[model samples]
Target: VFTLRLIHIFAIHKQLGPKIIIVERMMKDVFFFLFFLSVWLVAYGVTTQALLHPHDGRLEWIFRRVLYRPYLQIFGQIPLDEIDEARVNCSLHPLLLDSSASCPNLYANW
Candidate 1:
C-alpha cells in the first residue's frame, strides 16, 4: 500500500496536477479497499487451511511456527484470568496471554 501510494503520488503527481484532488480521493478509497481485501484473504486462507488439513501435523507446525509461537513470545503465555488486562486491551489480552508455552490454549478457542 505504501509503495503503491508513493508511486501514485510521485510518478503521477505532475500528470494529475490539475485533478490531484480527485486522484487523491480515489487513491484513498482504493487503499482502504485493498487493505480490507487483504485482511479478508488472510482470514479465508487460514480458515481454508484448517478445513483442508484438519488432521495434518504440517498445518499445526506451520501455524505454530509461523504465527502462534511468535505471538506467544510477544504476548507472554499466561492464563486469561491471570493476564494483566490493564497492560493490554481486552481484544488483545487473550492473544497476548496464555498459560501454555506452545499456545494450545490460544488455538483451542480459535
Candidate 2:
C-alpha cells in the first residue's frame, strides 16, 4: 500500500507514466492480501510453537534475565551524538526545542 501510494505520488509529479501508475494500483489489492496471509502464517506458527513447547521456563527466564533491563532502559532514552540529533531534528520547526516534538523526517525533507 505504501509503495503504491508512493508511486501514485510520483505519478502526480510526472516522474512516472500513467501505465505504471495503473499497474501499481491494480497490484495493491494483491499486496494487501499477501500481507494479511503472511501475518496469519506468523501468528499460527507462534501459537503452534507455544503449544508444542509446553512450559519449560526458558522463555520466561530469557525475558526476565536478558530482555527486561534493556527494555526498561530503551523506554525513555535520547541520543547524545550531535550528528544524530541534527539528523533527527532537521525536519522540526526551529522554535520546537524538544526532540520528541519534532516533525516527521521524510524523503522530501532530505
Candidate 3:
C-alpha cells in the first residue's frame, strides 16, 4: 500500500535527518570552540599587557610571593658595586619600561 511505503520512507528520513543534524551541530561546536580559543588567546595577550605594566598596583595578574632571606640572597646575588652601577646606569638611560620600577635603574643598558 502507498501508506505503508510512505511510512517506511518517513521513518528512514527521520533517522537520517537527526544524523545529519548531529553532524552539523558537532561541526558547529568545533568551530565555536576554536573561535572561543582564539578569542581567549587575544584576551590573554591583552590581559598580560595589563598585568606586565601595572600602574597603581590594581592589576590582578601580579602574583604575590614572600621572598625568604636566603632565597633573596642566593637568588639575585648582585654585588653592591653592580647594584650601584645598575642604579646609576638605569637613572641615566631613557627607555621607560615596567620591570624597571623595582630598581631605581634596572634596565639592561645594552
Candidate 4:
C-alpha cells in the first residue's frame, strides 16, 4: 500500500534517526531511576509505619499512614506546628492525652 511505503520511508529517515535513538536511551534511564525511587519509598514507608503507628489495625489506614503520608511529607506537607504542639501537650500532661495526638516514642529532644 502507499501508506505502508510512506511509513517505511519515514522510518529510515536520516534526520530523525538520532532523535529516536536518544529517546530510547532516555526511556531506559528513566526506568532505572524509577526503580531506585520505588526502593527508597518502600523503605521509608516501612520505617515510618514501625516508628509512628505500630499498633495500627485497619488495612486501609495502614496504607495511608505508611505510603500516602510519607509521599506527601516529601512535598512539604509536614505538620511541624502540630508536632510542636503535641510535644508541648505531652510534656505538660504525659498521662492525660487523648487519641488525637501524634507523639512518637523516639527521643526526648526529638
Candidate 5:
C-alpha cells in the first residue's frame, strides 16, 4: 500500500530521526500494492462460473475446497440429472480441463 508504506516510513523517520528503515518503504509499498492488485485481478477474473470448471466426480473440486478452506468459495445447487448428462457427453476429455473450464456439464444443455 503506497499510503500505508508512506505513513509507516514517515512515522519511522520520526522515531529514528530520518534514517532508512530496515526495509525500504517504497519496496514495501510496491509489494503490498502488487499483492493486493494480484488478488483483486484474480477476484475479478474468476467470478464467472463459466470460467471455473469444477468436476463433481473425477477432480472433486468440492473436496478440494474443504481441504484448502480458502476464500473465493462458492456453492450452488446442481441437479443430479445434469451431472449425469454431462458425464454422458463430456467429449472434451478430462485432459483439457483445469480450474477454469466451467463446472462439468453445467452447460450441457447448451
Candidate 6:
C-alpha cells in the first residue's frame, strides 16, 4: 500500500524518523481540533435550525442549512440579509421571495 511504502521510506531515512513522528503527533492534534469543531458545529447548527426553521421537513435542505451553510458562513460566506430580519426584503427580492428561501424571523435576528 502507499502508506506502507511511505512508512518504509521514513524508516529507511534516520533523519526523517523524528520528523515523521512529529507529523504523526501533529496529525493527532489536528484530528482532535477537527472533532472539537464538529461538536460545536452540530450544537450550534441544531440550535439554529430549531430557532430559524423549526418546521423544516426536507432532510436535504435541513442538512444544508445546518452543516453546509454554517461551514461556509464561518469562512465569510455569511448571508447578512438572510440572518437579519430588518435587512431582508422578501417581497422585492425574487431570490428571497422564493418558496425555498424565506425572510429571517425576528427571533433568528436576535
Among the numbered candidates, top lDDT falls to 6
lDDT of 3 at 75: 55
Tell me the whole-model lDDT of each prediction, alpha carbons only.
0.49, 0.47, 0.45, 0.64, 0.47, 0.73
- Residue 104, model 3: lDDT of 28
Tell me the TM-score of each prediction against the true structure.
0.37, 0.32, 0.29, 0.64, 0.28, 0.76
Q: Count of backbone clashes for each model?
A: 2, 0, 0, 0, 2, 0
Model 6, runs deviating above 4 Å: 84-99
Task: Tell me the RMSD of model 1 versus the true structure.
Answer: 13.5
Clashing residue pairs found in predicted model 4: none
Q: Residues 56-85, candidate 6: write the lDDT tens digits.
A: 555776788789877886787876667556
Candidate 3: what lDDT? 0.45
Evaluate model 6: give its TM-score.
0.76
Question: What is the lDDT, from 0 to 100, of the residue 14 in candidate 3?
Answer: 55
- Error of model 1, residue 85, in angstroms: 47
How far out, in Å, is residue 57 in model 2? 4.4
What does candidate 1's lDDT look like per residue over 22-101, in tens digits?
77689899999989865765565466445433433444454644445334534566335424334423222334334322
Best by TM-score: 6
Q: What TM-score, to 2 decimals, does candidate 1 have?
A: 0.37
Query: What value does the lDDT take at residue 1 in candidate 6?
Result: 100
Candidate 3 structure quality by residue, lDDT tens digits, 1-110: 99666655665685665676576679999999889765665555455434433342424323321122223334564335434643443222235533443232234311
Tens-digit lDDT track for model 5 on 1-110?
89777766675566653444544567799999889866754554343222334343434554343333223322343334434553543334456544343344345332
Residue 88 displacement in candidate 5 (angstroms): 19
Model 4 error, position 64 (Å): 1.1
Which residue pairs of candidate 6 clash? Answer: none
Off by over 4 Å in 2: 1-18, 56-110
**Distance (Å) between predicted and true CA of 66, model 2?**
19
- Location of the lowest summed lDDT over 10 successive residues in candidate 3: 61-70
Looking at model 6, report the run of 10 residues with the lowest lDDT sum: 89-98
Model 2, 5-110: lDDT tens per residue? 7766777765467867687788998899888865665554444334432332345533432334333334543223322435553324344433333332233221
